[model samples]
Target: MSQSKSLLANIGVQVVIAMIIGTAVGAFMGHSAAMFAPLGAIFINLIKMLVIPLVAVALISGAAGLGNSTNAGKVGFSTLAYFALTSALAVALALIMGEIFKPGVGIDVSSVEGMFSGEYASKGELPSFWATVTGMIPTNVFASLTNANILQILVFCLFFGLALSKQPKKNREPILQGVNTIVDAMVWMINCVMKIAPIGVFGLMAEAVGTFGFSALMVVFKLFLVFIAAILVFGFVIYPLLVQLFTKTSAKSFLVAMKKPQAVALSTASSMATLPVTMNTVENELGVRNATASFVLPLGATINMSGNAIYYGLVAVFFAQLFNIDLSMGAYVAIILTSTLGAVGQAGVPGPSFLVVAVLLAAGIPIEGLPLLFALDRIFDMIRTALNITGDAACAVIIDNIAIEASDLTESEVKQS
Candidate 1:
């Protein structure tokens, strides 16, 4: 009981620290903000340095661990459905917020158009929707590794897992169990790495506060407000509804379980880095089965970025308005759809929403509007990561409830039958 209380206290501390840090960064002396910004960068880099190998190994082994083909499909479909629904909701919320606020109505359009740089070219690098779908299959495993290609890695894992599922039991069963053990061990190792989180979080906060003072925020205040509001709605309102509708479990219980991990996510500002805590919260606290938590949390960490989707959609609209580009209803729909895809596509990158903004601009929306946004991205990222963590926990609760209720109902019917 003491340990549980201590854990809860730590979570409260984390959230308070994140807010204090973000506010300080937004309001402090400019030179100080600049001096400390490197600390945050170093902290972000440490987690990112570990992401590629961690994701590749965890995902591949996650796939191979699915001993049965049927179980794999059930897990896969559930995970994807959650990602799709949450992402769509994120996009819708962003669009609605952007239109209502008109954040760019009085901004200097020249700041965007005049300062446009060639670096933005990479924004157009992604293929069309169909192209991304078709390209999911990895052509060269080593090449994908060298390039740190997440989609390719995801593709490889799925196929390899499917093959493992099909192998004769004598050949596959032991391998599946062994792979599962190894993957779990890898995740454990990552948790050991997370022991450094407080130091890293402090560094990240100090630097961010020292570098971006509050005066600079005036340019993007409306955008920041929109994002915060959307995150609140999704985190507090939408997630609860989904949990109640799908799981028949207590949403209150789910939120209670999520407290610690959500705090960690806010401080760290990286969902992937927060996975160990998230998994523990879902399985140990929320009472999700290990198999479901393991399968769902990691995948959600990587791809179910509701916060990123919201930012992408809103930023696209903000840039369009700043450029005096009137978006037709059709254009707005495309923005929502494309940004949803982009959120998943660009997951795990630093300032990924910037890339999404550039992508939208290439379609003629105005990429130049991003500089004003760049000033506030770090601040927004903190909130976005918190929302992302919340969404993942909500999905876990809903899925767990679904699986459990199904089991209970089946048992009851069987008893009667």
Candidate 2:
């Protein structure tokens, strides 16, 4: 009884069971399974309610704590570099896979003619670089907070935290202590919300399967298989290799430790929603310092979307192939660069992936067939989300080791002197 209870208590095991049952229900009940959607909505709403405050408090803690370290600048640079480079690598690999497999080669667009639409055409235009950059700055912090404008909130809190660190300890500790207290309260609420994760997973999976059904999937099943293959390569092969190369954490152990957060990411389909669980698992199970986990994971959840990179690259190639368009060398370069930047810009939220449109437009691919994918986006979103959080954890592991190595090198040099 005790052993069985433990298994049932494990969020990962419970989520897996819920997913299986939910898929079965959706397959059986078809559209009727959408009724279960309220469970997912309620759970997601509860998580969203906690997430804004959590991101606000946790990021402040991370920035302030790291600000006190001698290597704060190094950590910041390395974290951003890792996110950019890995995202580039992910998209490049996706392009290679798409080229080799050619999933869209024999696809018959005529059968799905009714589904195609040019309505999404206007959305394909990329926002100008200056506009995107300027948008990150906040005019009013309170208004940004109310609207859940994450980037602006991040900028303000990071600035506020770093500025706070420059103050005398007498002035800083009380506010820091109070913010830490709020973070603790937020974590407590996350734990409470997670207790119902199984129900949410069931509802979400049921609704996704029932709404999209398997018939539409036949048109894109090859794309699905290839996408999963690419995700597996990135998740298992690339991430594990990087961890073993840079950190003391064994590849197997890192993968094992990440199972809980990956499950949560899969069910919730939002990195922001999965942040608390990722922070907990990375710090406690994976033995990263709280400050490093706090710093890297949140930053990663916001910008490091390697999974989205892969999806965008593959979607561009899929559409190019579907139209029999012989993409130029310039088009490949455009696909890679646009996909990389687009992936980084993606908000850490659950929804249909619209970033693929920007990548397609960059390469001059048609946007009509995109509507076919919108229906299946939820399925793709769930799988890629699990991969996304895995990348976030991998960064925490590797960055923490970099800090450790830097400190040890400093100590050694001092002793030698």
Candidate 3:
């Protein structure tokens, strides 16, 4: 309880300080005041650099262990289902909040002239849904590794791992055991790498607060509030309810287990950085089975971006409103669809939300509106990371209920404790 309170208080203080600093710079010094942006950028880059290798090695090791075709298929389906449900819910929440708040109604588009000049050429309509599916099968596993396309790499790893497992027991047992040993060592190394994350997070936060200042924050104040609210409600309330409804776990115990990791994720603002803590918490504290945590937490860290999905949808509409673009109902639907996918595609990067904002602008809305929001990105990113991890835990609990042999405590004990 003390730890939980401390974590919450720490996150609150950091957010408040960041907001005050951001508002002051944006309103006072203006956009040219980019003195601190590099600090945050460097911090974000370091975390991202670790993500590809972490995902590749971890997924390969985990999948390789689950050699049975049926079990592998079940894991794959469950993972995809969780991702789809969370992403869709995020989009829906954004749409609902956007309508209720109408955050962009009175904003002046011209005041921020020359804000964003469409500098980065659009990546074009994210290859259709089919493209995402087809592209998963890498032409060459080595090529996928070189390209660092996580989805393709995951595909290659899954098949490769299963093939090794399918080999005759006499031939495969020793190899599988040896691979597990290597995996254990690599995971330990990854955990060691994460010890420095707090420094990276502090630098990123300091730099972001330094550059953006507070003035730009006021520009999209309403939208920012709505986005944060949506993330909290969905990640904390809606997800817990679902977990309790489906799993024999109480939300309180699960949430208690998540407290430390949540703090790490919030401070670092990188789900990947928090994965080790998340995995440990779920397996040890929450008593989720190793198979469930290994499969769910890692994948959730990479692909199941509930908070980003919400942010993307809300920001797209908010940008449209700020620019006086006036999105039709159809456009809103398209935003829901594209933003969900965009969030996943950009997950491998450090600042994918900002990058995807460019994608949204090219799709039709005003890119200039992004500058105002970008100022608040770091602050929002922290909250979004917290929410992301929460979603990951919730998914783990649900899957554990479905797959784990037995849990340490009953749902009632989970609540009472």
Candidate 4:
């Protein structure tokens, strides 16, 4: 009885079980599997319901903790720079993998050519750099909170947290305590939502598999195969190597602790939805301090989309090959730059990403064939979202180590003096 209870208690085990059952149901139920979609939707909504408040209070607390320290600026810079560098690396890796694998070389697109559409053409237009910067700063934090404008919310929270930290101890202490209390409560609510995670995972899997069977993926089966390979290489190899090299946390421990959040990310396909689980794992299991986890993880979820970068880069190469277009050096440059930078601002949600359109267009690749992949986007999203959250944890781990080292150095210097 205790053993069974423990199995039931393990979120990873439960989610895996749920995914297997869901696949079976999807295979059996066919189109009727969509009935389970609301279960997944409700689960995602519940998580989203708590995300804004959690990010707000948590960032404030994290920033407040670091506000007086000189490491605050270093932490923020390192987080942003690390996200960009890793995303760029992800795109470069995808392009290399896509070129070597040539997943699109022998495909018969004429057969599914009817599925193509120009509907996504307009979405390819990315905002100007200045516009994107302006967009991040919220004029009204309340409105941004109401609308769930994540980028803006992230900016305000970080700024507010820093400002709050600068206040007098009497003023900051009670308020920081209150904010920290709210963060703890938010985590409690997140844990509550996770209790039903298995059911939600089952529903999401059932609907996705039922609606789009494994057969639909056969058209792009090679793409799927190569994409999975890229995910493994980056998630298993690159991120783990970085963790091992930079931090005291062993690669095995990092990967093992990440399994739960990774599974949640796979089932939900939303980094934002999985943020709570990521935080729980990074801090409690991985031993990252709250201040660092709070600051890095939230920002990473909001902006760090290395997973999307891989998807975008690989999809561009796939289509360019499918159409027999010889990409110029400039085209390759455009693809790498676009995928790397464009992924930075992507919303960490479950929807089919439109950023592929931008990458394709920037590289002068055809966009009409995009709809073919859209059908299987859910499967791809699940795979990549798991990678995305893993990258987030990885950044948290590395940055946490850097922060610790800097603190140690500062203390050592003071002692010497």
Clashes of each: 9, 0, 8, 0
Per-residue alpha-carbon lDDT of candidate 2 for residues 95-210, written as tens digits (9 for 90 to 100): 99999999889988788889889888777777789988898899999999999888888889899989888899999999999998998999999999999999998998898888
Which residue pairs in candidate 2 collide? none
lDDT of 4 by residue, 241-340 (tens): 9999999999999999999999999999999999999999999999999999999988888888888888998999899999999888899889989988
**Candidates by TM-score, descending order:** 4, 2, 1, 3
lDDT of 1 by residue, 327-413 (tens): 888787777777666667665444536557544854467564556666667778877888887888888777666666656776788
lDDT of 4: 0.92
Candidate 3 structure quality by residue, lDDT tens digits, 1-417: 998778645533444444445445545554454555565456555556556666665565567655543355666677679888788888888878987888887877677666766554453456667887897788888887777777787777667766776788899878767766765665676565555444444445555555666666787889878887898789778988887788878877776667677777776677876776687788788888666676677778778788888887887777776666767777776777776676666552345366455447544776645566666777788888888888888888887676543333345466898
In terms of lDDT, the best-performing candidate is: 4
| lDDT, candidate 4, at 303 | 86
Candidate 2 at 59: error in angstroms? 0.7
Judge candidate 1 at residue 366 and give its lDDT. 56
TM-score of 3: 0.80
Q: Tell me which of candidates 1 and 2 scores higher on lDDT.
A: 2
Of candidates 4 and 1, the better by TM-score: 4
